[model samples]
Target chain A: MIDSINPTAKTVGMLIGSIALGFTFHWQLNVLLSLVCLLFLMTSKRAKLSTMVRVLIPIAFISVSYFMTGWLFSSEQALFSLTNETIVAGGRAELINGLNLGTRILAFGMIGISYSLTTDSYDLIVSFIQQAKMPMKVGYAILTAFNLTSLIQTEYEHSKLAIQVRNLPVKGFDTKPLFTMMVRMVRWSERLSLSMEAKGFSEERTMHRQLKIKRRDIAFAAGFPLVILGLGMILAR
Target chain B: MNKKELTLRDYLLMALISVVFGVFYLLAVYAGTALTTVLTPFGLGVLGYEPFYGIWFMAAIITTYLIRKPVVGIVTEMIAALIEVLLGNMFGVIILISAFIQGLGVEVAFAFTGYKKYTYKVTMTSAVTATVLTFIWTGFRNNYLAMDWRIVLAIFVTRLLSSLFFTGYLSKLICDKLDEAGILNSMQTREVHDR
Candidate 1:
């Protein structure tokens, strides 16, 4: 269900909705939204338990750190003094603010993870090209580059190994190899473009794959923000 | 200088460069996250993360330099942000906004140069412009105004220096090395021949 929705809509909707929700500073509302997002993730077929765990671990760490920071460093007045003299300001407002910030971060992460796990990168690019009217040449080039990531990673590893084998002076922060790799990749892109041109790739080309927005996609695209906004309003009150 | 449409080669180069710097950006995010966690207790939470802010703009600056195009910086940064989101960045959808602003900052800087100059001085000026623009945007967005003035100042200064170093000095250095390797000249030659 999540995968079938237009990526551009999902991305734009989630971005706009989340940014709107983030500024609300209502901890309860944010928490409810985050839980709803988590429920969505849990129900999605693409979101595995392991993936959830991997994503949440960082969110948990960040939330904890945010809470700690807000508690300790917030300039708000102290609601109550702690027993420890070093512990200066322990305020209810500050604690709530921390929770709000942390949970908001988690909510944002959850929304992102849902989009990423469900949406294919190619589909996203295609949606950009088709729906958002991005230039086809630029879209295809981005697709090519995206596909080349693993290959580039492999080459980077190989270069590192080669440097090790040759016993080169592996100084701290050595960027020479990086620059060389970049230049090489640029050259490869040049060649690739030449080959593509030879094959008659041009501005006006037909796409074989068709992207249609189904009824379910419309429901999802419209329903998500409305539901979140409703819940936010209710909870804020 | 005659304006030319970007070729497939230019787009691909932008992508390639974005991918390379995207990795650096991912690492910087990790480092910034860790430092923010470690430093938050000392009231230096936001300031601690300032240094990593400029690394985000490196791809945009470097790509603009290499491509010497008007919107390449914005496009490259957007692509990089997409990749980051795809890679499961915790900031998620908001990364797009950050990337857009950062890219626009560099794009505006280049625009000030009439998209003609790619000098070290121009690069530095662009970096500073981008840094200041982003700083202001983030400050307003994240409610940094509520924070103590000292922390805000520290963040601003550190972010400026970091942007200057990574996007300005470091990107220029890499482009110079690429030029020295004759790869840039070859690409230029191919572009001329194709034209």
Candidate 2:
């Protein structure tokens, strides 16, 4: 169901919702928002459990960091003392602030994962070209580059092997191989552009893959943000 | 037609480079998360995470340097942000707004040079401008105003220095290497002749 929705609408909705959620400082509201986002992800048959787990790992780390740091550094006045003496400074207020930021981050992550896991790359590019009115020249270039992912991976492995054979020190963050790979990729991209021109690719031509906004797309585009807003308001009180 | 306008080749090159840097950005995000986590207990989380902030702007600077077209920095960074979103970035769609702001900042720096200089000095200037703009924007967006001024200042300084190193110095080094390897001669020569 999610896969059938228009990628552009889903992305725009997510962008609006996430930005709105980012500004709020209420932990309870953000937590509720995150739980709703998670529930949506869980219900989406297209959203893989493994992908959700992968996305959640980083959010988990981020949330912990936000909670700890916000509690320590937030300027909010202490709501209570940590010990018999006010040794630690920030108290309940800081904790709430921290949790708010942490859960907001989690909510953002879940929304991103849901969209990416379900949306096809070709559909996304098409939607941008058709719905967003991105320049065809720019859109096609991105599509070409996106299609080169496997080739890039192969080149990376080859470069790594070549480095080993050349006895280059495989030390920390060696950028030589990366730069060499980039140079090669740059050359390839130039060739790709030339070949595309040779094949008569033009901006004036319309894309064959037509992007259509279905009923589900409209429903998701309008419904998701409203749900988030409603949940945030209800939970804030 | 303006000869300096970006051609199809320029777009392809920018997109390819942005795709490569998109991978690097993802790795940096993970490293940044870990570093932030480790430093949070010490109350230096913001400062500790500052160094990775500049990495995000590298693609824009490098793309601008390579293409030398007006607004290529912004376009390249936007494409990179798009690729990141497609890769399921933890920050999601917010990356798009951040990228646009950072790209605009770089574009401003290049414009200050009259779009003529691709020197180390200009690169550093662009990095500084981008970092400062992004810092201010994020400060407001992330509620950094609620933090103590001392911590905010610390983060600002650290972020500035990191941008200098990553986007300015390191990018220049890479460009120099590409130049030495003769990979950039065609573009530079064309640019010089155009000028």
CAPRI docking class of candidate 1: medium
Per-residue alpha-carbon lDDT of model 2 for B62-179, expressed as tens digits?
7787777688888998888777666666666677888899999888878877778889889899888998889877875566755656777888888899889888888888878887
DockQ of 2: 0.53
Candidate number achieving the greatest lDDT relative to the actual structure: 2
B168, model 1: CA deviation in Å? 1.7
Could you give me the TM-score of model 2 versus the true structure?
0.88
lDDT of 2 by residue, A1-237 (tens): 466779898887877777676655566666666776677677777777887788788777766766666667775332332232234443556665566556655666667667777777788888998989888888888888777766776777677778989887654345777788769877887788779989998878776789887788778887777777776666544
iRMS (Å) per candidate: 2.9, 2.6
What is the TM-score of each predicted model, taking all chains together? 0.89, 0.88
Model 1 Cα lDDT, one tens digit per residue, B106-151: 8886888788888898889878888888887776555553344565
Restricted to chain B, the TM-score per model reads 0.92, 0.90
Candidate 2 local distance difference test against the native: 0.75
Chain A TM-score of model 2 comes to: 0.83
